[model samples]
Target chain A: GAGVSQTPSNKVTEKGKYVELRCDPISGHTALYWYRQSLGQGPEFLIYFQGTGAADDSGLPNDRFFAVRPEGSVSTLKIQRTERGDSAVYLCASSLNRDTGELFFGEGSRLTVL
Target chain B: AQSVTQLDSQVPVFEEAPVELRCNYSSSVSVYLFWYVQYPNQGLQLLLKYLSGSTLVKGINGFEAEFNKSQTSFHLRKPSVHISDTAEYFCAVSDMSGGGNKLTFGTGTQLKVEL
Candidate 1:
């Protein structure tokens, strides 16, 4: 693909429901990242993947938020028991490699929890 | 820890007027700085970056930023801005020490270029 792609541009779910957001990074890119942005705030880091392994996940606010990249290309961000506070735009980005290269971001999936 | 601070939360200027968005950072290690623009209903796009050399770095869309190591600041400036340039601008940093692409972003500033 020419750019990073995210599934389900918008997702609305009830409290305590589970949701999964998917991301398809640029072809041959070796790094993937996830971020969350709240209203009137900047995007906050969530997780980073170098291939199939998670190189960094320290930025995740809590264990309820989880992400995985099984084959180093497409990734999924899973949230358990969604809360109203969890409502935000979930952003996915990709880079040429883990060490160097600026990020290319997707349109993002807007999650609204009722 | 790396933290970025955008001095102004909102800035309004007349169309074609020069503008400057302030940004400062605190970090113990060397870092790379970037300026990203987010238009309405869109994701972020890199305007410019300061990786190394030349305190001043030029980016797309006629945007340029200067990295000041002593002041720990990277301020973006443009001689003139258009209505299309009216968008949310973010200042971000990534430490090379981290050896990865983990970015710390500022609170963001809304640039409103009025006619």
Candidate 2:
């Protein structure tokens, strides 16, 4: 079975640039989640999608962050005018559903804002 | 809102020695507790969880955690640890409040097993 995967294992960009991160969830999984983890810290929830809609986006730090799950199978997290503070490992996860209680995580996309 | 706290930032133990990574969470309602491990250059992997029914939850790779309601803690413990267990262990709590499946994670405790 294929597990969750994120593209561009690593990304480096300058401040004030726009960036898009992609996530591919497990087969038949209906829920997807995104998180950010800075060095020396645990992952923090950024957003989550249930089916084709975002179930929650409160974890997003500010209006500069937005995410979408158009086909319900894939999700894209977009950041506008990124800053050095946004540099971190962006992680994606999937489960049968949000209530499943177990989450399979992607290897994570390490984003470095130079 | 829910939050988690891990007591130790790093714990170094000898191989075959007992070890415990302490975690405490604060939430207004009942919640689910989980332990995740992150190997170097990798993402977090679920080790164990406690939703209901059992106070002691066993997870993969010979690890377990106990959920304590009165103390507001879900501490991960292993009777004996191996060098292969060296990794960053995170304790998290997820409570679906206001349709938030967001997991509140602790700062993480790095477990180093010395030979």
Candidate 3:
């Protein structure tokens, strides 16, 4: 794709269940980011990956939330023991590099925990 | 550390009227400012950015913003707005100390353009 791509545009699951969201960044982009946006709020940083390694994961809310990019192109966000409060739009973005400061975002995966 | 403040939660404007979305930031070190727009059921799109040199930056869809160092603000403006411009606007800041990668965003401002 010419732009960032995300899977599972909408997901509905019961509380305590697990879920996984996927993101495919633009080709050749070396930096990928994940953010969460709750209702009526702006997107909040979650994690960032530089190539196959996660250079920064401080924005992750808790241990339940984890992300990985094995090949430095495709990334996945895994949530364990999801709660109602975990419902939000998980956004993925990619850039040529962190220094460029210009990120291309995907449509986002809207997760609803019931 | 860096933070952004968008005082107005919502702004209602008539079509063809000028609109201004205010954004302010606080940072201990140098910072990069950005404005992004999110339409219903869509991802955020960059409106403009203030990195260096030019305080006044122009972006797509005839939108522009000015960077005020003293006031620590980057207000988005358009001479005339269209109904299609109605969307949620967000102000974000990134500190230079962090390589300007992670962005801290304000709550947001909903711009409602009516006929």
Best by DockQ: 3
Q: Runs in model 2 with CA error above 4 Å?
A: B96-101
Give one digit per residue, the lDDT tens place, for model 2 in B2-101: 8999979999999999999999999998788889999987768889988789899999989999999999999999999999999999999988554324
- Itemize residue pairs with steric clashes in candidate 3: none
Worst 10 residues of 2 chain A by lDDT: A95-104
Quote model 3's iRMS. 1.0
Q: How well is each residue in A1-114 modelled by candidate 2, as lDDT tens digits?
A: 488989879999999999999999999999899999999888999888889998888889999999999999999999999999999999999988577468889999999999
Lowest summed lDDT window (length 10), candidate 3 chain B = B94-103
Query: What fraction of the native alpha-carbon contacts across the interface, defined at 8 angstroms, is recovered by model 3?
Result: 0.57
**lDDT of each model, Cα atoms only?**
0.92, 0.90, 0.93
Candidate 2 lDDT score at position B57: 90
Expressed as tens digits, the lDDT of each residue in A17-96 for candidate 3 is 99999999999999999999998888899999999999999999999999999998899999999999999999999988
Candidate 2: which docking quality band?
medium
B1-115 per-residue lDDT for model 3 (tens digits) = 7889999999999999999999999998999999999998888988888889989999989999999999999999999999999999999999877877688999999999999
**Model 1 reaches what TM-score against the true structure?**
0.97
lDDT of 3 at A1: 63
Query: Best to worst by TM-score, what's the order?
Result: 3, 1, 2
Q: lDDT ranking from best to worst?
A: 3, 1, 2
Task: Give Cα distance to truth, residue A68, candidate 3, Å.
Answer: 0.6
Rank candidates, DockQ, best first.
3, 1, 2
